[model samples]
Target: MIDAILPPAVVAAESFDDPPAELFPEEEAAISRAVDKRRKEFATARLCARRAMAALGVPAAPVLPGPRGAPQWPAGVVGSMTHCDGYRAAVLGRAEHVTSVGIDAEPDGPLPPGVLGEIALPEEQEHLRALAASRPGVHWDRMLFSAKESVYKTWFPLTGRWLGFEEAVVALDPAAGSFEARLLVPGPVVDGTKVTGFAGRWLAERGLVVTAIVLPSAGP
Candidate 1:
């Protein structure tokens, strides 16, 4: 499901079932103090991440979280991981071919009551309302949340800065299955280009909403 949204430069691996809890010694120590559910999710997500790294022709390594809980990748690699109930996925790319990657997954359901107001700006709320009216089946609010996650995932790697939920305004195109996040804060510079926003694709199917953003390396 994650592969559908990412570019060819990215290698994506996803699993619907939780595998046995296996982890590298370092990875286990990172989450050893967490609850059982957190441990399981962390293990499964790293498993998916190793598969993606192998597909990208990189040797497998323990994926430990760095600052802000972002997965630290091997040198010369950029990637992201996300896991939710019944699903986990990882996507990776070589830094020479791809600038950065961000992917997220969530249940295809409405945002919990009142949560949207806190995360979404007023303009985004109006846009989501129109989308909800036109496409009643999809949970636009939830999709917006997922898109923001992807945006921040992409943003942090490039800038090493925090982006608040309200700092990026997302506009989702229901027909295109795509969204764009315009950063209200100062943006990052990548490959000599200043990135003011990120454009990504989203898919809602099989009871999940997945979003991905892949920025390619700048041409010489």
Candidate 2:
């Protein structure tokens, strides 16, 4: 599922079932005080990450969390991790080939009541409503939340700033299995000119929704 959106330069690992891998000591130390579920998810996500590193030909090392809880990748590497029930994935690329990457997975279900109102702008909600009207089976609201999350994950490393939900408008094209997030702020400077938003791809299957974005062409 994750491979469809990634380029050949990117190495990715994915698991539909938990693999028998333990957390490295440093990773364990960071999550030691957390609940068991959190620990399990962290360990599993790292397992996928390790496979990605190996595929990228990087020696194994501690993939620990940084100040803001984002994974600290090896020097000259950029990557992202994502996990949800029945799915976990990691993508890695050389820093020269990609500026940043973001991936997320979620259960294919509707957001809890009123969540759409919180995370979407008036125009965004209207768009979602139209999408829902056309495709009644999909939970477009939840997809927007997931897309916003992917947007932030992709945005932060590039600009080192916070991106509010209302600050970006998401438009999803179910037919194409893609989405675009238009920034409401000054937006990040990609290449030379300031760009409005990030482009991403999505997949909804087997009761899961997965999204990914990579900044390869938009150099660092």
Candidate 3:
């Protein structure tokens, strides 16, 4: 059985242990296998997604794979899922009533080298560099990485295309524990062209960094 932790709607977190069976057990086992660690990570993510849907009063539907290796949620609901080392989290909301939501969690650690150059937009890279220089020991790099992943999850479902790190600019307000992301060059994946804003927050705790993002709802 999976364990779930839920908070109120403003922000929430959920986690669960990996299940023994792969989410889809009926399919023929492929000759090549994912590393043990990745399989565990996938199980944890699926487990959290189920619990999160239940917490949000959405259907706890079975995990189903969709194009580009993303999970497919039941109709009328929007959500995001993520997992790292030992924890997973999912955030879901009624897209008709609430805007798009994205959630991500990762084990806290030193930032991977060159990560900033890859993910931060030009202005954002300069801003974060200055901030890091000003406060030498801060974990701004990790926070920024978490923010980027959250932004992608928030944007991908609505746009249906992969977004590059340079295309999205992130601005963080440390005092408020919040951040905002803007899509600079709408990529080939997005259509209809109305999504213009992204914003979110990051919380660091117990060796983990968690962030969430909100995008406007696609209306009827």
Off by over 4 Å in 3: 1-13, 16-32, 133-137, 187-193, 216-220
TM-scores for all predictions: 0.97, 0.94, 0.80
lDDT of 1 by residue, 100-150 (tens): 888999999989999999999999999999999999989999999999999
List, residue by residue over 1-220, the lDDT tens digit for candidate 3.
1112222342344554666534545221421277878766766676666666776677657665566666677786777777877677666667664556677777667678877677776788788888678755447777788888888877777767887777788887776778888778754332355666677877767677777775544455
Report the Cα lDDT for residue 182, model 2.
90
CA RMSD of each candidate after superposition: 1.0, 1.7, 4.3
Which candidate should be chosen as best, given TM-score against the real structure? 1
Q: Per-residue error at 94 for model 1, in Å?
A: 0.4
Ranked by lDDT, the better of candidates 1 and 2 is 1
Give the Å shift of residue 134 in candidate 3: 4.9
How many backbone clashes does every candidate have?
Answer: 0, 0, 0
